[model samples]
Target: MPTHTPPHTPTHTRPRTPPDAPPDAPPSAPTQAPWQAHAQPDHREFDATLDVPYRASPGARRTISIYLSYPDQGRRHRASWQLELRTRKGAVLRRWHGAVTLGARPFTLQRDWDGRAAGAAPLTASGTYRLRLQARTGNTVITQEWPIALGIPPRLAMPAFRPLATGATHHVATMTPIPTGTILPSYTVYYGNLHSQTNHSDGGGDLAHCTGAQDPQSAALGPPDAYAYAQAHGLDFLMTSEHNHMYDGSDGTNPNADPRQATALYRQGLQDAIDYNAAHAGFLAIYGQEWGVIANGGHLNVFNSPELLGWERNASGQLLADTETPRSDYASLYSLMRARGWLGQFNHPAPDQFKVGATPLAYTADGDEVMVLCEVMNSSAFSHSADESESHRSNYEAVCDQLLEAGYHLAFSSDQDNHCANWGASYSNRSAVLVPGDAPLDNTSLLAALRARRVFATMDKQAQILLTANGHLMGERFANCGPLALSVRYAGAPGRTAADLTIIEGVPGRNGAVSELAHTADITFTPAPGEHFYYARLTQDDGKLLWTAPVWISQQSPSLLCAATN
Candidate 1:
């Protein structure tokens, strides 16, 4: 084991202000900000150390950093290195390749391995493994191997039923009796980013080849690193929904040389998520998969599943069979998901020719019961349009509204659909769940809140909705008469105020147009009959927007009936 000296703590140097400056003058900027540095390593002594533990946990990362002395003090050394994980039998499990160059002074090279073979290979079995580091310089080679072990720990189980604390009052006046299984109403909103990726899929970063660069061509953050990043950014929950088939070796290149390797990689990634959630208490990590079909079917992200379910396509790009179903049966897939108590959501639903062609409801006679939500707002630049055009921006809203009209009853959610490792930093979208303020911030509670439809999707991090219909919060279903009273209250991020608020209401196939409601933060309204679904849209002075989950109102208590059936 090499002795380790922690990375230097950055020192902030404030600029000096002029003596004649006024008291109210703005403060000077810091002289040396951390992000301002170039890609070159710091000027320090040569050091090599592993940041990982001796007994590595499965799905966790083992990081190694190398600081090399200035290239012979004069002659430059265009050096490179390779890091490999080998089994006790001397067979290579995974390998990472990278370039290393020394500056005028000592500089560092760092990379991480997530304990799996490259390009979606299965996680290595628990046993003794050797991490081999090879440094090459003009025919002179230096090699070092360190023995380590890997194992999986017991997972932390969630409580079956944790009752909501008493003494909380409901804002909505229930026309019917509250159901026995309904989650309590004392809920507070928690923010999270539901869509993201690690190196397990097509996204970049995390590999030795990409690390240490100012901007790597690929994603550098692994699952554990991504989780920490999200927590540091103030997110309550983070779900990295990697593409299910992205590692399936279907492209014919067969990077792993084995078809099963892809599935193994996907499973390892999910396992990593579980370990992270168990290790972190306050911050919740949810496991999910983004099922994509570039040829036609579009994309769907299924969450909270005990195992993985993926679609299989033929060589011609046509659907063949899924993990379980014999044929390309959407209903069968939904059945399995429902059986497992899983939740499926439409990922960046297309508006034009790229449309999924089949809405989530189209898969089953009871899609509303299975497909819990749809992405009304996705922040991916590739999937989302900057201009709020009908073809691009309005298409998502239109599709969601159309589904609601058709009786799909799907809640609206916003996600970054982030391929880059940006995670919660993408302030354009988030999934906000209304959980009991005192409820345990665990997977069970969070999923329960989502299943209850106590959620709102927002584009701005600071935006919030205190919406109620005859006292029921957004996403709640209620039985009301011809005229229903609706209340909407908006809160904007600091330095920003609500500019306009609009209410949209309609039944499926009817004229669903938007009407200006109010410019203030709060407003009340009475809607006419036949308006079965209603939702509010708020625009901020800064041009950021937010859309709340729809509130379904019916003359009959269909919501209660729907809940009963589910």
Candidate 2:
């Protein structure tokens, strides 16, 4: 069947947020306040859980444990704790208020119930529930909450598709199997702000929030259709970074003035994703929001814990976990997310999208951070020329290059930023994560790999861009550079049955400047000393060319003499 690209920008407009709902919601649990006193910097821990096989016949006690971790010290914080359980439909299921020992500082906290609700009331039907934790020390709240999932029975519920949080990263797809005894690597992509018909400034989608909730057309193409499309097109995962009307006030900076309808729609979209995931297993969707900051270039996406960040905004109209600080910008958010062990990345920063500057990498202080990634491909900018698209891709590549040059760690990815399915026709099956086709496509495993700096990107076609150093498949690097030995492959039936490979290189540091390196049937690029970076493009005999992100190179030579001179 012939496919058409979804519209790059939605035509229908949505209404601005109403004057009621609180603009800034509280920051979710996992995204804790940066100032929560890490007195024992080693005492901090991140906990998560999963209960996928929740249905176990009748009278069976289904249970899952809260996975714990202390990235610092190897101490266990196992002690008495309290548990909170909520239903999939957003209702309090039961609150187990008691002292339960955790035993291990970084261990799973498991709880089993006899399929009962409150007061020993039997849970009439089998389903799913959300579990959260409150760790305390001498009546003091040590941790706000540790979110986890529960498996009740009959598999009636599934988790929601969350959007990437501020400075977060993401991905989707399958890959070839690696030889035995050798470990294969995976990649992640992150994106958001897919407004189908909602008010460009406010209005959250009305129906599942996949599109504009206010627009009937968008409402019709809700979560189910998105899920079906992903599964049919071989996509591994999809995420929605819907704008929070509550966070973006009517005036653009009022956190306490979001309309009720927008808030309701955001709430509904998250629920829809959770409900859809329950039925479709491998094809996953995540729930997240654009935290809708009103600043010139301040738009941060938040995911995972929705309830905690309910109405957490400040006078300046920016998201305030507790109080505002110097690092309130994108880089600061990245730093905070990395410190807390969450994946974050900088979105597009061009004049049309973010209007911040030519590049957003300068915002990151010290230029040295851990577990961070950047957006190389944004869905909104796909239709632009190859040179235009490469600018953003180069921005991310430059960051990756700086990190590699300085010995710090960073990664790369691409995102649809699909507000609706408007751009799907051309970009159909375009965005994806390169994970081992055999690995469990579950949230825990995929998310862990994503945070570990493993990912790649395809701008608008299936162009193969491989990053290897010294013949070793280590983690990815940002920009295309010399001695990097980058290989790009493109294979698609654009118009003709056969395809041709071409190398596209940008003008050194100027992303917009471009030149053709070579046009050949050969698929590999052996970089020369002056070649900064190179990407492969495939064209059909009919003349349709597909572009891929560049494999960055270093200007310095390998020998000590050349390296010392530069």
Model 2, CA-based lDDT: 0.38
Model 1 quality (TM-score): 0.57
Which runs of model 1 end up more than 4 angstroms from their true locations?
1-184, 206-220, 249-260, 313-322, 325-329, 352-363, 381-395, 508-531, 556-566
lDDT of each residue in 1-566, candidate 2, tens digit only: 00012112221122221233222332453642432211111112222222212233356565544332322233333334466666643378788643322222333444566667688887665433445555453222322221222233322111121211111222343232232222234333322222122233222232223321222222345555655554555455665555443333232224343344445555666687778778877556765555433223434444443431323343444343332323224455445555555544444322212222344333343223433444543443222221222111112333333333333343455554444343232243243343453455555655654554444454433333333333334243443333334333333323222233455554344434445565543334445554354454443333222334444455444566654543
Best by TM-score: 1
At residue 298, candidate 2 shows an lDDT of 36
TM-score of each: 0.57, 0.46
- lDDT tens digits, residue span 172-274, model 1: 2222222222333555567787776666554434322321211211345667777887777777788877666545433212223343565566667778878
Pairs in steric clash, model 1: 172-471, 204-218, 204-219, 205-218, 205-219, 205-220, 206-220, 405-508
Q: lDDT of all predictions, in order shown?
A: 0.53, 0.38
